[model samples]
Target chain A: MDEFYHLIDWALCLSGLIGLWFFFSRTGGPLNKAQAYMSVFREKGIYNPSYGLAIAFVYALLDIALSIVIYVWFYNDYWTDSDFGIAHLGRVILLYTIVLVSLHVFLPKIDNRHLRKTINTVDYHKMGLSMAAFVVVCVAVEYWLKRFVYGMWYGEESESILATVAVVASTAWIASSVYTSLNRYESIKNASERTLGALKTRHAPIVFLRSFVLDKPQRKGMTFDEYICSTFALNSQPIVSLSDPDDFLPTGGSIKIQSTDEEWESAINTLLMECRAVVIFEGKTVSLKTEMAKIQRFHIPHDKVFVATPPQNYRLAAWNDGKITERKYTLNYIWNDFVKALDTYGGMHGLPETDPGECMIFSFDKHWNCKAPVKKTGKDFLGYVVDQTVVHENDKCDYISLAEKLNRFELQHTQVLSKSDEKRIEKAIIKALIMSALMSLAVILLIKLLVK
Target chain B: MTPTDFQTIEESLGSLFFILVLIYYFTQLGRLRHRKKLDDTDGVKKVKKQMLWGIPVFIVLFFAMVLSSSLLL
Candidate 1:
């Protein structure tokens, strides 16, 4: 037994010494796996800082666990077996404070530009003080929790390792896991809010129309007032004739809901929010040149707009010093062009049928689950005859208003991740942390009580 | 067995447990790198491969130490 003990002890002692050598050197050696593992985390450090901090916290905590195990192993070798002094525990914790801070702070700061940006040259002392405070706290936990616990357990003639198992497994893992979860939760919340904000502030759609359309025949042969009723109704979509105050208003036009010349731009802004399609009749007396420019400025997608203008002798393109160029076409002309576009577009894509306007029926999630049972049939969402992401496919419902509350401040009428989604993720993170704590507790108990 | 022996065996087993975890985590990292087609950082690729090989060897060695200590009369 003495010979075997000496043999195995010599081997472990040699390997441990080598591992220490490799670790301190930070060379391409056995410790490279550790370095590689860290670099993987470092790669993600910039774009998602909170997630990166979570990784760092986890890695530091795990390293400390491994260090504790190694410390216990070495205690018997360096000191009298299992009769370690408080000074030795202090020394070990002091070493961890140095090593963990180096890895977590200094190492990241050295190479990562993102980490470097955290400190201005002038604020180095302040940052240094904060970092020192953090390290002091970490070392205190390592020292007090392990050393003091070991003292009590040792007094009962229990092994010193029992204390380490308790501290490293239960206390350390739980604290680190909870911290990581909170960091990730804050990150996701901020990210979700930023995305939703961008969506809300976006410019809405606009439709251009001629005043003649309100008073003229509804369609090619129908005579109803276009405002009260229209011909060739597309799923009963109203041909809302949005007008400018500058346009020549023939009598009997629909401006019972009208604005004056001073409020014309404001009126267009209002229409930009609500108008779906514009049908401008290209006659001798009407034009929507400013409204067209506003539509261009808002970046309204072409599919949302259709223009109708009379055929001209020759198309003209604007030019200035080889830089300025634009094709001048009336909204009415664009309407005819849009029909051509629909033909070419539908021939290749088989779409425009599934186009979502102001609202939708069943949401993407619901549509997916409902359609996926047939498996491959619903791959093309447009091909599905039913409109999704709404209640009962009601376009008139103004689903955005009646939409489910996403969080305290907003509603989700579309497929973008809502605050509720973020909350669900946060809850999952908490559940995972709790499960990890429970598992760590179980293992700590098993290890500490196993000797009995 | 002496308390000293228990301590030695426990240390070996504890080290084995930690190493097992490291191996599992490193394996996950390796899988992640491959899945994401990640480029290797300085010395990481070589060390990762070496560690992958070295861990199992260490695992076996630690297991032997624990088993032999546990069986000693």
Candidate 2:
């Protein structure tokens, strides 16, 4: 029980190391995301200074929070025992204050051109070096803390031991940081290609079928469904959907039987959820192509999208020439070529589950709690989010189920929605405050009456 | 009302008042969740998930420790 505090202390110490990593190495890792976000707004004419300031402000506030949490339990010790713990708490407050002040005052003032150049680059070697520094710093601090505590128990001073250890560790970290900066590993290799190849070799598959629209009449007077049926002969398991344009009805019990226009967003979101690979007929309407772009933005590998910018890529028939299967002038031939491409680049047998650290097949929360699809024949724990259930003719459902529903009657009447229309911060704190006050009053009155 | 009477009532009803406020706030958060934009999905749900995971575990451990300490002694 006495030693439980040591665990908390050590955890906080490690957290400080993590916080420090997030602090200085704002070029890669978590801070890289913030910069990417800021870049978007920077194009929209937001002040460039705001980017660095935002990163530093977030870093400072998080560290200040970390410091407070680390020292809060010591308040009990101060009141019950002595002022020693309070002194340590004061030190924590001071440390966090210094960090906050330094970042808030200095980060924006860093030469803007240099910052811009540096921030966008992803230096994996720099990240590796930071990890090394964290290990070294934590090891030294833990050792010094142990020695100091042991010395205190034995009524002997160990400040010299602690100082020597800390200094050596910090110096080593500084050297490593400098080395990483000077000798950056410039391996521009696609890291995931090897992993994808491995999945192919293991027969983990990557096969896909999404909307195959032939809005223009099929060549040689063939119908869209007839052409689709011919393509499915190559792999009977893969069925091309002969969809109704108005079949954008959701698969759940939906009150709003949204028309085709109303269903577009939900339908596209569903495609992004289910289909990893997409094939859109080019030289046609831009709608399907737009859907393909959205999936690509969802970070489906580039090779997964096959658009026959026809006359160039349009095919009719294909021949398997031992090593390669060559295609002829047929639409099915284009699909055959695409299947081969998918087998090569995407994967042969497995679902398009991203390897660890790569973006998942479908995850809305890009910031956290991302789960990739499970590989070949394995189902991902993560599934599609359904907005409604209007049952398409093909019975091809992307929706898992409705998570919940909002009270539109009340929500529409609320004064302030989100900070911006685009931003969906759904919690209405002002209304919540009013409700809480009323509830509190009602409870107070009820309690008073009951007591009387 | 007299100051003494106010103080007496306040002391007795304070915990009840706070509990009701907590309930109201949680309910309102749940209600507001449905109003989220299509792309802005899982806004309040994420916070709810964290709280659901965190609070009960802490409460259980707290009560367990207190009971164990007294019982063992």
Q: Per-candidate interface C-alpha RMSD?
A: 22.2, 22.4
- Top lDDT hit: 1
lDDT of 1 by residue, A1-452 (tens): 46755765676677566555544444221122233434543442322233333433443454356446535543343454243444343433443343333334322222111111111123323433433344345545655644664333554445656755654554444444334433333322322222111232222222334433323322222212322222222223322233322211211212222344445556555555554443332222223545555655665444444333221221111110111111222222333333334333222122123211211112112111111111112112222212221122224423133112212222112222246644553454344334443444444446445533
| lDDT (0 to 1) per candidate | 0.36, 0.33
Model 2 per-residue lDDT tens digits across residues A1-56 = 33544554565566556555544454332234334434433333332323333443
Please report, as a residue range, the 10-residue window in candidate 2 chain A with the lowest summed lDDT: A381-390
Off by over 4 Å in 2: A1-99, A102-163, A185-452, B1-65
Q: Count clashes in each candidate, considering only residues at least 3 apart in sequence or on different chains.
A: 16, 15
